[model samples]
Target chain A: MNKLLRAGFSRLGRSCVFWLLTSFSAALAIFMCAVCFKNMNAHGDAVDAGQLMLNYSTLTGVVTAIFASIYIGVDYSDGTVRNKIASGHRRFDIYLSNLTVTTAAGLFSYVVFIITVAAVGIPLFGSIIMPLPRLFALLGCIFAAASAYSGIFTFITMSASSRTVSAALSLLCALALIMAALTCLGVLEQEKEILSGSVTDGESGEVEFVYSPNPRYPTESERKLYKTLLDINPAGQMLQLAGRAEPDFKLIPLCALSEFVAFTALGAFIFRRKDLR
Target chain B: MEYVLETNKLTKMYKHSAALSGLTMHVPKGSIYGFVGRNGAGKTTLIRIVCGLQSPTSGDYTLFGRSGGDRAIVRSRRRVGAVVETPSVYRDMTARENLRQQYRILGLPTFDGIDEILRLVGLEDTGKKKARNFSLGMRQRLGIAVALCGDPDLLLLDEPTNGLDPQGIVDIRELILRLNRERSTTVLVSSHILDELSKLATHYGFIDDGRIVREMSAEELDAECRKCARVEVTDAKALARTLDSMGIEYRILSDTTADVFAKINVSQLSSALSSSGCELLTVTERDESLESFYISLVGGGRHE
Candidate 1:
């Protein structure tokens, strides 16, 4: 296992995909910061460092999905996975080594994004408005969420035999998670009764607002389910971190940790039984 | 004789068909063992199972006298190296980089002998050239170089010269010979290219329908190969008629040539052909080829 991890990390260090994605992440942070800086200069708008820092969450999902898939899928496609197995490395060790490397890759991108955002955004927008401890805690949650994304995508890539299919599936899974999170957020954000429209009396030139119950609003039990889904889903947690709503800080990391463990176990189990050519 | 690898009724079943069914064979220590089989005859499947890339459905194999089911079998596998099907190479990386990666995986103390391994495979000067850009032969050599990283005792090469030019085939053959000669590495090479295998294999195991049909030393096979008199005549049809009336077994090579399995009087055959108004050309007696021997064993070439 140690040898596998060392080799995996060595490969990861020289991986073009990991470096390219990390650069893109950093460039994106710079771009976002520039846009915010331009807005502040042009319109005298306030910028929140916390929100900008949390923006890495949005990128983590897609980045981790693409990175993990390509990183792990190459083994199967190029037939290098056979080398590891034929060299007497256990299947579980191979799986876990991949997971570790991919998770580290995800974290690397996340850190680069954070550092880039802080280096540029702090000078332009000032320090985070939220307490330092609170920001750190949220950062930790986002890190956990990123690791969970690694776990999920690693499992998908490892289970798949073809690199092309695994990549497509992983990207699709990431998009689905994000869309599901947005849908949940939409449902949970609905008001019990909303202003539907304005009604004008026929006789008087006066307008009165009419209110109606939100048809899309969830029931009491349904609301709890959606909330729990939002808390558990990595993308949903990302949305929460990005200030879509207040995050259940304690539960988010707990769920992310559970997901990491579960997916790692399942992926290793599947890989152990998998037959390679 | 001590066997480096021994399988007892090893079986592997896929979803619809069995890839290996009650197959058994052995590779003796320090011998170049040829695994001869046609396509889909479970050659790669058995190699994959031995390499730990796939598990057998039933039965098991012993590597270096260790059972496949034992925990120490992993250690036993450390003495083995294989390049099954295509060469397992990281095409994106250069040959040296790929070797370094393999060395790390093997947990070698250092990348000390990579240059030597590369030189052994005739790839020492492939500097800065990624394996993707390499020719098929170079990539194959790189694959062998990677397999030679840890100085393994047993080497498994499956169709190593599948898509090679004549020169590439000779190079690989020479490299295998050198490895076996210098390091005393036991090699199990599976190929349908009987002529090439005949050149390298000291022992041969012929498999059919997921089972080994026969296993014999090269000396035994040489003794078993049939001898026949090859004859060329003016008219094969007339020669066939004369030979058929003589109650002799033969195979027609062409319109004017045939191999007679039975001994015949030269003058009698000549007079018989002359009586039929056909002239006998020439005759030479020689042993049949390994291809003919294989065809005689497996029944025929592939049927389209």
Candidate 2:
């Protein structure tokens, strides 16, 4: 409904959380840019924007989670949700409006951060490595990841009544998931170290060197499982997308987009059944 | 009678208790219907359900002409507004900002009525002051202002004057009366203060144990609680016979006492009683108030 959108957008525009997160993200982006510029000035070789973006997985994921959680949580704490429902707006419309606004805000702040970083990083670190279409695909992946994060955080906000608890839990859970995904990626990236086992000297039948293979490297099936976790987890997809892996349409992007759909639907469904009292 | 709201066997059950059990009542159009009940008696639950904040477990209700599950019911709800339990406002925002948020949500083309509603609720001067800093009465008035947006045909106020001083109570009372009398807006107000409701309600529904124990117009309630003469005599048998000959509506209380509904010449009754060999001991006029009437229905011993 138009009324729902108007109300939701107004709230989003005036939300302190939106402004705070935007500032935080802008500061982070600026800090990264300054560090890159300093590195280029001192070493004559600027930091790679690709590596800088890779770290955005944890940064953007956690920040968006905090933003979305606190944004929706205030509506519940302030009892404004009842106003919309009492005004004859459908529950689905209210939920959808919040989702749309939070997603849009998330995307907007992310773009601001991207532009701020690009303003410095492109000139110093060099232009984006990929072609135009490929860059667009990567941008799409980031947007999808941001939407999924919004859905998840919104779901948590609607499920819990206490704003403080919802925000803390959302932040903690998002970070925990990112850590889990990072650990899985770390395991996948472990290389098998060559260990000489039992080398015998040709002249004397004496064992000169003894070595064995490092078992810390993931097996093929274990590697598949870790890859699946990385693909399915929003934070993991964010990390993988940031890494600029051959942007095939199959894994990380699909996971992020599907999660966006799934979490939004699930959040809307739960909110519809929620009682304001 | 044209009813603005009607419920059929509405029941709401909590995990361990039933807040409302088979509550079926009607609010006639163009009347200030008072919903009287003690705490935990389903007053707020009924309001919440009708306002779409919660769902009735196993019942249906109709607003205007639309049933609960019908798509048109939403349109019907556009004609209704309610403040359930507490004022739903953003505490950090100023009063004007709060109303502006509500106005935008109500989809009014312009902010035309925002100032008008603020003036109507006596909050026009609450400029730049956040609702959290306003007094309780100011917040209450703001809540009513929010409900008054869109000029709804029916308004529901739940304990609108719960924590107000005498002047605040009078302000809210006068506001409700002015809205009803000037606008013909049907109001369903729930409150524990019977005397306060008595001054405002045109119709009364006495709810106890989650049921409507009585529903009547003000005139009917007045007649039931009207002043009457109480006469104590030596023998009610002879007094009844004497009053029957005089043709007065009366209720016999005991063998030696009776309540006489009509005014009578005490001297004539004394002379008639003496002729019947009965002594007239005393005569007193009495009228039960709304509080006593509610006690009679819900029992005088139980406390809210």
Candidate 3:
């Protein structure tokens, strides 16, 4: 088990995929920060550091999807898994190694992005609007989301034998998670309007008023379902955390951790029975 | 005999056909056991089952001493090195890197013998050459090098020389011989190249129709494959009387037939038998080669 972990981490840290992902993600955050700095100068509007960080965290999902497909797919295409098993390593260990390495890489990349953003933004934009404690809590949720992303994508990459299909499925999955989060964000952006009444157009002695409940506001059940969606989807968690809106969203981090555990366990179980060919 | 591998009625079935049906065979310790069979005759299927690439549908096998389904079988497999259909290798990695990864998988404290194993397989000079860029022969040698990393007690090679040139074949044959003699590693090599295996195998197991038809030592196969004559007569007792008098070695296959293992005058034998009130019914010259013997055992080649 130690050897598996050591070798897995060694490959994970050294592979081109790891470097490409880390650089891409860190570069994306810096680019987004630069846009905000420019916006502050041109429009004389204060930049929201927390919102900038939240908006760019979506790159974590994109970066993980790209890296996980290529990195894990290489094992099947090259037949190295056979080398491990034929050398007496269990299948469960192989799956766990992949999961651990991917999660580590994602976390490491997220840290790089955070540090880069903080180095530039703290001086340019002044202190962040969200309190330091809540900010840290949000960052913790993002880290947990990275873990969940690793588990979910690793399962897809390992299950499908074809690298092309695995990669396509991974990209599609990542895109779908972000799309779901974006939909939730769009829904929340609208202020719910209830008991609406409009009256008095005084142009031609027109005096009329109408009142009704707002259709856009989600109902109690809809609110619960939407929150559940945000809680389970790692990308949604990242968005929520980056926005600094989840102080009471305590269950979000737990959901992310559980997603990691559940997906890893399920992937390992299926892989154990799969024929290597 | 002390057997390193023993299978009891081992069977494996696909959805539409049986790959190994009630097949049982053995590999004695310290011998190069040649696994001879046609394609689709369960040679690779059996190799996969024993190597843990696939499971048996019925029956079980024992490796070293532990049987299948035993927790110790995984530990027991640590003593086995195998090259199943294709060489299981990381194509993008260099040869040395590939071996190092294998060393890590085996959990060796250090990459102590990587250099030695590479040198043993004649890949010492493949400096920084990724396996994908290697020649077919080089990749094969690298595969064998990977298998030899753990200094395993049993080596299972499936078509080790499948795509090699003549020189490559000789190199692999010599390497197998050396490994067996120097290390006493039991080898179960499956190949359709009977001529090469004939030179390397100390023992032979001929499988056909997914079951073993015969198992014999080299000496036994040599005796069985020798030049001989098939003879039939009206009275075997009289024919044996004449052949024994003439000091010819023979096996009485049936009441009216015998295979005589000597050159003789047909007329003289006929006259001798007739004088003893026996009639010579037929005399056919016979010489059975190994290929012919295998075909005879399997009934015909490439038939469903």
Best by the DockQ measure: 2
Query: Per-residue lDDT for B183 in model 3?
Result: 93
**Evaluation by lDDT, superior candidate among 1 and 3:** 1
lDDT of 2: 0.84
Error of 1 at A13 (Å): 1.5
Task: Please list all clashing residue pairs in model 2, or write none if there are none.
Answer: A196-A211, A197-A211
lDDT of 1 by residue, B1-304 (tens): 9999999999999997999989999999999999998988899999999999889999999999999989788898888888999999998999999999999999998999998998899988989999999999999988988888899999999999989999999999999999999999999999987889999999999988899999999998876666889999999999999999999988898999998888889999999999999999999997878887888888785722
Error of 3 at B38 (Å): 2.6
For residues B1-304, could you state the per-residue lDDT of candidate 3 as single tens digits?
9999999999988887999998999999999999998888889988887877778889999998999778678888889998887887888788899888888778888999888898889999989888999999898988889999889999999999998999999999999999999999999999876788999999999898799998889888878888988999999989999999999999899999999999989999999999999999999998899888778877884754
**Model 1 chain B weakest lDDT span, ten residues long:** B295-304
TM-score of each: 0.89, 0.91, 0.91
- TM-score pick, better of 1 and 2: 2
User: How many clashes in each candidate?
Assistant: 0, 2, 0
lDDT of 2 at B108: 88
Better of 1 and 3 by TM-score: 3
Off by over 4 Å in 1: A199-208, B226-286, B301-304
Can you tell me the CAPRI class of model 2?
Answer: medium
Best by lDDT: 1
Q: Tell me how far the alpha carbon of residue A238 in candidate 2 is from the true structure, in angstroms, after superposition.
A: 1.0
